[model samples]
Target: MSLKPSSRDWQRAIADARQGLSAWHVWNLLAMTDIRQRYKRSRVGPFWITLSMAAFVGGIGLVYSTLFKQDIRTYLPYLAVNYVVWTLIQGIIMDATGVFSSSGVYLRQEAMPKTLFAMRLIMRNLIMFAHNIIIIPLVFLLFGVWPDWEMLLAIPGMIMLLVAAYPVVMLIGMISTRFRDTPVIIQNVLQIAFFLTPIMWKVDQLGAAAPFVVGLNPFAIFLRIVAEPMNGRAPSLWTWGVAILVIVLLYAITGPLFARLRARIVYWL
Candidate 1:
C-alpha cells in the first residue's frame, strides 16, 4: 500500500470533520480524559484554578478599583465577570495552536477527524471555565448584585462565542502544525489583544474614541454579549449583529483553507 491519501481522502477528511460533531461520545470522553489527566494526583484538582482565579480577581479588583476611583461594590463583580470570560477566550485561542500538534500520538494511531481534537481542546477549557466560574456567584452575592431576566441573554451570547471560536481554532491549529513558530506569534498577538480589548477597564473610559476602539474589536463585542446581560442590561442589537458578522467573516476566510489543509495536518505534525 502506498499510504498516501488521495484527493478523495481529503474530501473524506472534511466530511469526517463534520461527522465528528455527531460523535459526541468520542470527543466528550477524550475531553474528560484530558481534564482528568491534567489534574490527576493533585490535591485540590481543578479547584486550584478556581482558587487562583479568585485570588487574582480579588487582587486586581482591589488595586484597580482604587486607581480608577470606582466603588468596590460595583467594580469587583464587573472585574470578576470580565476576567472569567476573558480567561475562556484567551485559553481557547492559545490552546488552539496545539490542537493538532499535541495530539500527534492519537492521530498516527487511529483514523480520527481533526475536528475531534479541536472539540476536545475546547471542552477541556470549558471544564476549567466551569471550575473558575464558581467565583462569579460569590462575587455577585458579596456585592449584592442581583441579575435580572436580562441575564438569560448570556446563553445566546455564549453560543455565539463558541460558534465563532470553532473556525479560528481550525485555522490556527492547521497553521501552527505547519510552522513551529506560529504558537509563539499567536501568544504575542493575544497579549496585545488583551489590552486592546476592554476587559480590565470600562470602554467608556476611552471617551469619544471608545466607539471606534470597541467597534473594531470582535472580542469586545463578544464580551459585551455575555457581560452586559450579567450587568443587568441586555447588549444592544448592534453588538449581536457585529458579533455574528465577525463570525461569518472568520468562517469565510478559514473554511477553504481548513478544507485544503485538513488531511495534511498529520504530515506537518
Candidate 2:
C-alpha cells in the first residue's frame, strides 16, 4: 500500500547486504564460474581478454597518435590506462542492468541475498579487469614509461571504485529487472557516454569546454581518479572531492530505494 521503506525493511536490506558480503565464497564461486564458462575450451582461458585489449590499445594507439599528431610513446600509455579503466567501468555497468534478471532462477528458487549477485557481478568484471591490466606493465616497458610516486594514489582510487560498485550495481539491477527495456536504453546511453568521455582524447584538447564536460560527467570524474594516477599524474583535488561526492550521493539514493524494493524485486523477475 505504501511506497516508503519501513524501519523493518531498512533493517532487512542492511542485513541482506551484511550477509551477502560475509558469504564471499559463494559469490566468488559464481563469479569464477562465469569467467570459466565464458571462455570455456579456449587455449588461454581469460587471457583472451588481455590479448584483445592489447590489440585494441596497439591498433588504436597507433592510429590515434598519428591522427592527433601526438608522440606514440606518450599517446600509447595514455590510451592504455584510460581504456583499461574505462573497460572496467563500462563492463560492470553493462552487465549490472541485467544482473538480477539473469540470475532469476536462483533467486526464484530459494531465499538468496540480492546483494550477493551484485558482488558476483563486480567480482566477475574485476577478474576481466585483472586480465586486461596485464597489458599495462607491458605497455610501460615497451614505451619506456616510468612510474611516479603519484601512481601510488591509484590504490585509493581503486578502493573507491570497488566501494562505488555495490550500490550502483544493486540499484541498476533492481530497476532493470523491474523494467526490461531499461537495459536497452542504458546500453545506447553508454555508447554515447563512451564518446562523451575523454578516453581516447586528452581533456585539454577540449579547451574552453573541458571544465564543464568533466564537471558534469561522473564517468570522466571517476575515470580520472584512477587513470590519471596510473598515467603518472595525481588527479586534482577537485576531482577527488567530486568522486567522493558522487559515491555519497549514490549510496544516499540507493539505500532507501533498495530498502523499499528489495522484497518486491523477486516478484518483478
Candidate 3:
C-alpha cells in the first residue's frame, strides 16, 4: 500500500466535496433532525440558546464594562457581536471533533460522502447561530445602534467565515478521529483563547501591544473581520489580508489531508 495520496485521491476528494454540496436536502434534513432531538419537548426549544446568549452578553457585558471602565452603550453591542460570532466559531470546532465519531452508525451503514457530515455540522451551527444572533439587533436597538450600509460589508466577512469553517471543521474532525485526546486539548485551548482573544476585553486596552496580540491570533483575525464590520468599523486591510491568506493556507492543508484520510475515517470508528 502506498503512503502518498495520488492524483486519483485528490480527484475523489474533490468529487466528495461536490457530492456533499449537492446532498443539501439530505444534510439539512439530518441537521434539522439533530436540532429537534436536542430540543425535544422543550417549551422554548432552541430559543433557549438565544436566551442563554442574551443572559451571558447582558450579565458579562455589564460587569466587564464596569471592570474595564468602558461605556455600557458601546461595550454591550460589541460584546454581543463578538460573543455571537465566537459561539459560532466555538460550536463548529467543538462539534468537528466528533463529526465523524458521533455519526458512526450512519457512516458505517450507508455509502455516504464524509463531507456530508461536515456540511451537517456547519448547517447545525448556522441554525444555532441564527437563533443566537437576534440578540445583536436587540442589543443594538436598546443601545441606539442603527444599522447602516456598512453592516452589509459583514456579509462578505460572513462568507469568508463559512468558507474557512468547512476546512477548519474537516481538518480538526479528521485529526480528532485519529487521536481521541484532540477534543480535550482543543477545549482547553479554546478556553485559553477566550481569555487571550479580545472577546470580553477590547484589544485597544492592551495599549501599545494591541497590534501584536491581534496579529498573532487567528481567532482574533476572523473575529475582527466579521465583528468589526458589524460594529460599524471596517476591518483593517491587514485583517482582510490575513484572513484571506489564512483561508488559502487552511485549504491548502485541509485538501491534501482530507484526501488522504477520507476513506480511512469511517474505519477509525
User: Mind giving the per-residue lDDT tens digits that candidate 3 earns over 1-269?
Assistant: 55477898999999999999999999999999999999999999999989988998999988999999999999999999999999999999999999999999999999789999999999999999999999999999999999877788899999999999999999999999989999999999999988888899988899988888887799999988889889998888989999999999999989988888889998888
**Model 2 poorest 10 in a row by lDDT:** 213-222
Instruction: Tell me the TM-score of each prediction against the true structure.
Output: 0.94, 0.98, 0.97
Pairs with steric clashes in candidate 3:
none
Of the pair 1 and 2, which is ahead by TM-score?
Answer: 2
Candidate 2 lDDT, tens digit per residue, 1-269? 67689999999999999999999999999999999999899899999878888999999999999999999999999999999999999999989999999899899999999999999999999999999998999999998998989999999999999899888899899889988898998899899989989899999999999999876799998899899999999999899998999999999989999999999899998
Candidate 1 C-alpha lDDT tens digits along 121-167: 88888888899889999999998888789999999999998988888
* Candidate 1 RMSD computed on C-alpha atoms after optimal superposition onto the true structure: 3.2
Q: What local lDDT score does residue 117 receive in model 3, on the 0 to 100 scale?
A: 93
Off by over 4 Å in 2: none
- Estimate the Cα RMSD of every predicted model relative to the unseen true structure: 3.2, 0.9, 1.1
Q: Which stretches of model 3 miss by more than 4 angstroms?
A: 1-3
Candidate ranking (lDDT, best to worst): 2, 3, 1
